[model samples]
Target chain A: MSALELAAAVFLLAGAGFYLAGTLGLLRFPDALSRLHALTKADNVGLLLVCIGLALLAGSLRQAALLLLVWLLALLAATVSAHVIARRALADGAEVEVRDGGGP
Target chain B: MRLGQRLVRGIVLYFALLLVWIVLDGTGDLVVGGAAAALGAWVGLLVAPSKPVRQRLLGALAFAGYFLVESFRGGIDVAWRAARRDLPIDPHLIRYRVSLPPGPARTLLAGALSLLPGTLTADSDDEGALLTIHAITPDPVNAVRALEARIAAWFILPREGAEQEGPT
Candidate 1:
């Protein structure tokens, strides 16, 4: 593959790795709020990186702009949904239980 | 601002959405795009009228820079903690008070804080005066404060006495 394609592949792989990390945090984190942090922050960066990679591969201005728009929409959705979930979780006292470092 | 000005804002929104629709659906669908844009602008006006803030273009550019760097850091931070065996985390919540008025500014702020480093914002108390933020670390207060200040710079906020009187 060409060097540009190679760079795109690197970004795509890194994005996937970040997505995995975010999912790991979602599964292992104790409470809803912490999970929200993982989902909103890590996953957002993951999507952003992936979009960049795909835009590079597409190599068309229209497609790249569309990818960017998709990422922006995802960011908006994630931010709003995370806030909703976090707010509800807090109201339900879901965060009342906190165990530092997975203590027994 | 009067109702007439809000109508003007709606017209601007209509054109903005029309351009977006044209980009998405192409020039062949002008009629559909125009009709949808008009409807969208109407709905937007009813749902949320534009609140005028003294926008700082330079501050917005600075904010964009800050957002990119912090979000990149945030992802790496999460990836590191999740990958480690120790799972080093000290999760807790704090009520971070904000000076921005109770409206779109605060909503946007809450949306932004959730994407920042180790912080997730929730509307728990104080009716937009305070944010209930959850952080994996013991103290994200300083980071949150810095972010808040950055975001605050984007707008010339209404003074204490002028807040009650809607957008001027």
Candidate 2:
């Protein structure tokens, strides 16, 4: 494969890894709020990486810019939805595990 | 907002929608594109009938740079924690009294903070006075306060009297 193609493949793999990590976080986190954190952060970054990889393979500037717009929209949606879910969890008075110090 | 300013904002939004339509539709058909863009802009204006927030271009660029770097850091940090055998999360919720006034700026700050490292904005009070955030780190209060300062700086707001202590 060409260098560009190889780079795209690497990015795609990294993006998939992030998405997997996000899912793992969702399953592992103790509460709804923490799960939201894991999902939003991982998915946003994953989408960003995927967008970059696809943009590199895109035929034209317009297509690349459109891919970026998609990433932006996804980021906005994730942020809004995460906030909404967290708010609902808070309102429900979900039990959250509180640890005092920074993790090792 | 002034009528003229609103009109200008609407026009700008209309053109932006047109550009998005062209990019997505991938067509050079002017008639359909123009009609759709106009309709979309009209709907947007109805939904959010206000002048866009004024942003300093340089400040916005700086904020974007900071945000991109920090978000990546945050993603890696969480990924590492998820991958470990023993989860190292010290999850806690802390209330922060927001210093920014009630407006788009405060909303922007809240949204941005949610994406930053080790912090997730859980809820805010009805009056928008206190924000309850979930953090995986020990010093969530300090982390959020630092981010708040960056956001305030990004919006070009003066930070003299707005600084306040975190809720205990």
Candidate 3:
């Protein structure tokens, strides 16, 4: 395989690994908020890597830009949804393992 | 806002929507696309109203570049922390009061903080001044401050009394 193709494959593998790690975190983390860390962070990274890999393979600037747009939209969606869920959890008084008081 | 300025903003929004349509729907008819973009801008004006912003071009570019780097680092950081067997999380909810005034700038900050690695904005007060964020890092200070600076750079904010972080 060409160097570019190899690089794409590596990226795709890394992306899948992140996705796996995110799922493990979701299953293993204790609380609602902590679980969200995995979903938002790892999953976002996974999507970003996947997009980069696909963009490299697509070999068109326009398609790469489109992939980037998709990832950004996904990031925005994740941010909003995670915030909403966390707000609801806080309102329900879900157990906060620790809380540092208000700081700058 | 002045009527003239509002008209200009609407026109800009219309063109932006037109570009989006053309790019996403390459084969669609031009007439229909134009009407749709116009309708979208009008509806957007109502649903997602925006205030006049004093954004600096170079500063905005810097912010974007900084954001791209930080976002990638954030992803890798979180992935590493989670993948470890130790888990090493000291999760907590903290209240952070941002310097930005309540508006799009504040909202953008909140959204960004949430998307970053260790901090997730959970709630905000009615004023949008105080944010309740879930933080995993021992010290989110430096990172948060850096991000705030980047965002502050993007929108030329007026200086407050003593904490003057003037446009950079």
Q: Tell me how far the alpha carbon of residue B134 in candidate 1 is from the true structure, in angstroms, after superposition.
A: 0.8
Q: Specify the highest-TM-score model's number.
A: 3
Arrange candidates, best lDDT first: 1, 3, 2
Q: Model 1, stretches more than 4 Å misplaced?
A: A97-104, B2-8, B161-168
User: Could you tell me which residue pairs clash in candidate 1?
Assistant: none
Residue-wise C-alpha lDDT for candidate 1, range A1-104, written one tens digit per residue: 99989999999999998899999999888878888888888999999999989988985676787788888899999999998988888779784533231111
DockQ of 2: 0.44
All models: lDDT?
0.80, 0.79, 0.79
Ranking of models by DockQ? 3, 2, 1
Off by over 4 Å in 2: A97-104, B43-52, B156-168
Instruction: Give the per-residue lDDT digits (tens) of candidate 1, residues B62-161.
Output: 9889999999999999888887889887788676656567666677778888898888886645556667777897767778767767877876677872
Better candidate number, 2 or 3, judged by TM-score? 3
| Backbone clashes, each candidate | 0, 0, 0
Q: Chain A TM-score for each candidate, in the given order?
A: 0.89, 0.90, 0.92
Residue-level lDDT tens digits of model 3 in B78-147: 7777778898777887777677765677888888887676888889898667788888777665666677
Which candidate ranks first by DockQ, i.e. highest? 3
lDDT of 3 at A26: 86
Native contact fraction, candidates in order: 0.53, 0.47, 0.62
lDDT of 1 at A96: 53
Question: Which 10-residue span in candidate 2 chain B carries the lowest summed lDDT?
Answer: B159-168
